[model samples]
Target: MGVDGSDRGEGAGQLLADGEAQISLRQAEIAAAADALRAGGLVLLPTETVYGLGADAANPAAVAAIFEAKGRPRFNPLIAHVADLETAARIAQLDDRAYALARAFWPGPLTIVAPIRDANAVCDLARAGLDTVAIRVPGHPVSHAVLEAFGGAVVAPSANRSGRPSPTTFADAVAETGDKAAAALDGGPCAVGLESTVVSVLEGQPRLLRPGAVTRVQLQQIVGPLAEADDDAKRSPGRLALHYAPDAPVRINAKAPEAGEAYLAFGGGAGGERVFNLSPTGDLAEAAANLFSFLRAADRTKPSAIAVAPIPEDGLGEAINDRLRRAAGFIG
Candidate 1:
């Protein structure tokens, strides 16, 4: 359970005592959460990557509510979460590459962008009026259960305000979106704490738009070469130049801590008055999962500057660095 299950028990109980609107993330309440979505209400649920603020993808009003809740720009698109491949195929025009990628990476971290079929039920607001939709089938059981129960596409963006750190733990999900969301479900900390890797296939080439757990090497193994996105490449969710930022000023590729700066260490050998290590053992996957949480923690210190240790661009590190660069407000 999330808030209803001893997460900030005092606050939850006080809210309950006040008889305000609140719900739990326990197994028994999945149906209620589904019902909320079916009625055009917003819900925050766990995913393998991170918690997502979700609404029915086919509901334009619901989609607009998400934009309002997150303060997200209407120009950026949202990823539609589906229960299964058949559900995905019904909404997007998938090709051979798309099929191969789905077979290999569905139920995992990967969002495939493809043309929306004329028969697609997803509303235009969800797709930001684009002809394509970014869709994925998350592997988290809680997310899967919700999707299966809801029995339709859910457009879920990370459950945080726009340009803020994405919530990985259930506690943070509830903390960030408790008031705006109808309910926030806790499935535990996310396995892949970063967002999904987004690839665009609408241009007839598999272009790497955003990196994640599924590396370009792995995608190429199934779909041949993946190209770098162009300057004018169609924007998807999380494509902003100044995204995933924290309250403090962020500096990336720091070899050592600057005086008075809070340092986010990747591996061993980083020292600071305020420090949080992403991975002390030099494991990139672990670092990827720890990136945003550590940043959030470091930001809490109210440090003069948040300096991040250099992360190698290998495997999941590419995705981690992608987020870091964006958080640091570096586009190139």
Candidate 2:
């Protein structure tokens, strides 16, 4: 805890000011980040979706520090990142559907929640002592390299303080987590910009716990129909009623921005003095990656309220709306 927050350093709060922390996508930096994880310390690394505060998944003490660093609730389980499918098979009991999806989307942004085997090394604290574990193989090269170098599972949740938007850039990761990370690997901006699409295959049928860049339609093709996970399940991560909130109140699906409101437009510009467009060309993929960054920008303007343009509830839009609904709860 003295330097790396290793032995229960929940006190490793934000120590660096704005622009003070830096992470470059270099071999030396990646090697140092991997070393930190191996030593029971936390490091912020890039993923295809968003930056994650990574810790040794097999070490309960290291996992606890992740909650301490982000002030994240213990009820939410963390996702285990694996280097390859061989590593994932050792941790989870992969069924036919699980095998199908993993083959379709490994080394990508899809998280599969499967029944945890007794042989798995992931700690109970990382899975909230549940029988199921959420697992994914990130597509980002930086994350993949670190996982290979670390040589074990790493539980990585979004690298942001609880209730705030996830960090999409290295700067964003530093601004949110501060010196909690012993080191960070800058892999530029995240491609998806949202968390992974979590599919729980624990039950008889497949369930979609959280939406991301992976569209519902794509999953349907491989596994017929998908059911939305129950609210009482509490088995998956990112299921809270109020999450990804900014400092200011957020209002979604506003036909037009009211007076004194900062408009957050999706397809085009909103008729407001201050406006930030998610995707002017109506591209859902681009909008998904830009969601949190734009929200953080709009919050800095100190508007009376943040009004959002209507977003289509298809494909990546589903994930975008999910975050918006949770952020609006900041007002409720």
Candidate 3:
């Protein structure tokens, strides 16, 4: 079934007779989807942060298939999604600091890398054969249900192909994975359209690997101040210079341009080559929610360049700036 639950038109209905290809509110349908995942099949499941293409983390072959399906780089590690603390501990070797952070942020948009003895057994591809495995317990009932029902950790990456925008809705997931996924459990749009903030705790000090819904401040409060990723670290995964970018070229400006450039502002602005207000009233949350959607829309114009007004470097604005900077190919 596709992400929308529509049959792939391959007569695979018999394989997923219990609402596999259709949006269903019933628990039985979710269970059926979970059953497919347990059988070493791919399932599109929802997380609070974004939709994920999930497979049993304990199965190396299954984990490798996820990389093959997404065309993701082998060096780019995958996160092990679990139902609870116990499940997360089973996959990764958690320290006291890791445990504290997990207890505080489990079922939320936070991922932590911890040392593992047999990374190959649980998920060789998930850790990329590294000593550490990134693990998290997502705060979505559908994801949790699927993981628990499968009775094991599930290796999940954003439900999109490599180097594409993450999918926030079931429709987007379908557009990304299509008939390849066994089933896409639509739990509704994600609250946080971005990915989880990944913090690596395997080392002596916590390091911020990636930023997302979980802010640096929030993480600081739980764990001590973290070392921001340097140039080398930023080159990893979705943090590449030209990543998370729209089809159009993007430019960032201090003030709204008068003409000749698309005026993307944080507040009021006149329309020109193109106009997109991150927030008409200067609301950061609103801007965050509208960022990707606007980027997707603006890309359709096929403009020569996209100009964006500067946003305050605080709160959600920080995350927005991070994405824009990367999109603009500014690694500095």
- For every model shown, the clashing-pair count is 0, 0, 2
Q: How much lDDT does each candidate structure score?
A: 0.81, 0.80, 0.71
Assess candidate 1 and give its lDDT.
0.81
| Worst-scoring 10-residue span by lDDT in model 3 | 4-13
Using lDDT as the yardstick, the better of models 1 and 2 is 1
Kindly report which residue stretches of model 2 are placed more than 4 angstroms away from their true locations once superposed: 1-25, 118-120, 269-273, 330-332
- Where is model 1 poorest over a 10-residue stretch in terms of lDDT? 3-12
> Which ten contiguous residues of candidate 2 have the minimum total lDDT?
1-10
Question: Sorted by lDDT, highest first, which candidate order results?
Answer: 1, 2, 3
The candidate maximizing lDDT is 1
Report the C-alpha lDDT of model 2 over 1-332, residue by residue, as the tens digit. Answer: 00111000111111111112332325577688889998999988888788899999999999999999889999899999988778998999989999888877776788889989743479999999888888987776667778888888999999999889998888889898858988877767876788988998976679988887677898899898988787425777887778998888899999778877888897764444578888989998888888999898889888889899999998788899999998888311
- Model 3 misplaced stretches (Cα beyond 4 Å): 1-25, 117-121, 230-237, 257-264, 270-273
Give the per-residue lDDT of model 3 (tens digit) for 66-105. 8888888888878887777887776678888888888777
RMSD of each: 7.3, 8.0, 7.4
- As for model 1, its CA RMSD to the true structure in angstroms is 7.3
Candidate 1, residue 125: how far the Cα is off, in Å: 0.9
